[model samples]
Target: MDGRRSDTRERIRAVAMELFTERGYEKTSLREIAERLGVTKAALYYHFRTKEDIVASLSDDLRRGIDDIVSWADATPAGPERAQEILTRYGALLHGLGRDMVRFWHENQPAFRELGFGVGLRYQFRVLADLMTAPEHAPLAVFHARQALLALSWSISMMGDLPLDDDECYGAASAIASDILRRM
Candidate 1:
């Protein structure tokens, strides 16, 4: 896509996320998103047919990041070192991707579930946890792995209103997640 077109799509997604955060997915509409972007509904439709399309576009980016991590983990040796690296990479991935999309995913889960985006994310989440507990894949080890990942996930999604900024939230979450892995 041309730079202008790509930029427009990103602007639409960013504004939609802001509205989705401020109002809510169910309460927010394409008309509102268009107004927020100062564009006509027709122009908005040229990029996205519906709010779900906006969300799916964002989700696709996140999924690709996770897929890249999974592919990297597959090549790396599995152990505490690999697990810690996964935690680090996962935290970075979530934070680097833009907190708006992750926050929207957390707040508008019902809409995501309805849109059929949640299943893939949940599956990939489990896969990451399993990757963290590679080789034997013990049940308890997997449990800790999942918890560690949740620290980073929740930090990105649920902690937006905290006094701390993104880097602080991520730093704290990464530390907590590292502790969780240490316990395993």
Candidate 2:
């Protein structure tokens, strides 16, 4: 797409996320998103047909990002060192996708479930967790691996109310996740 068109799509997504965060996915409408973006409903419609479409567009990007991570993990040998590296990489992926996208995903679980994004993300998490515990696939090891991943995700949603900023929260989660891996 052209630069202006891509920028419009991004602006729509960003405003939609803000409205979803403030008014909720179910409560927020296309008109509200358009008003927030200072665009007409027709213009917003040109980008996204519905609120679910907006969520799906963002979630699709996230799925592709996670898929890329999964592909990377699959190419590399599996071990604690690799798993730890995955956690670091996953943090970067989430941040690169934008905090608002992750936060909205956490907040609108029901909507995402309906849209199938939740299932896709959950599967991606399992694949990564299994990679963390690779070869053995031990239940306990997988448990710890999942916990480590959760630490990264929780940092996006749970830490929002905390006094810490994004970098601080991410640093704390990464440290805790690394420590969790050490236990396994």
Which number leads on lDDT? 1
Model 2 residue-pair collision total: 0
Q: In order, how many clashes per candidate? A: 0, 0
In candidate 1, what are the lDDT values of residues 49-88, reduced to their tens digit?
9888888899998899999999999999999999999999
Which residue ranges in model 1 land beyond 4 Å of their true spot?
A: none
The Cα RMSD of model 1 versus the native structure comes to 1.1
For 132-162, candidate 2 gives per-residue lDDT tens digits of 8898999999999999889888777776777
Superposed by TM-score, candidate 2 places the C-alpha of residue 95 at a distance from the truth, in angstroms, of: 2.1
User: Which ten residues in a row are the worst by lDDT in model 2?
Assistant: 94-103
Candidate 1: Cα lDDT at 118:
95
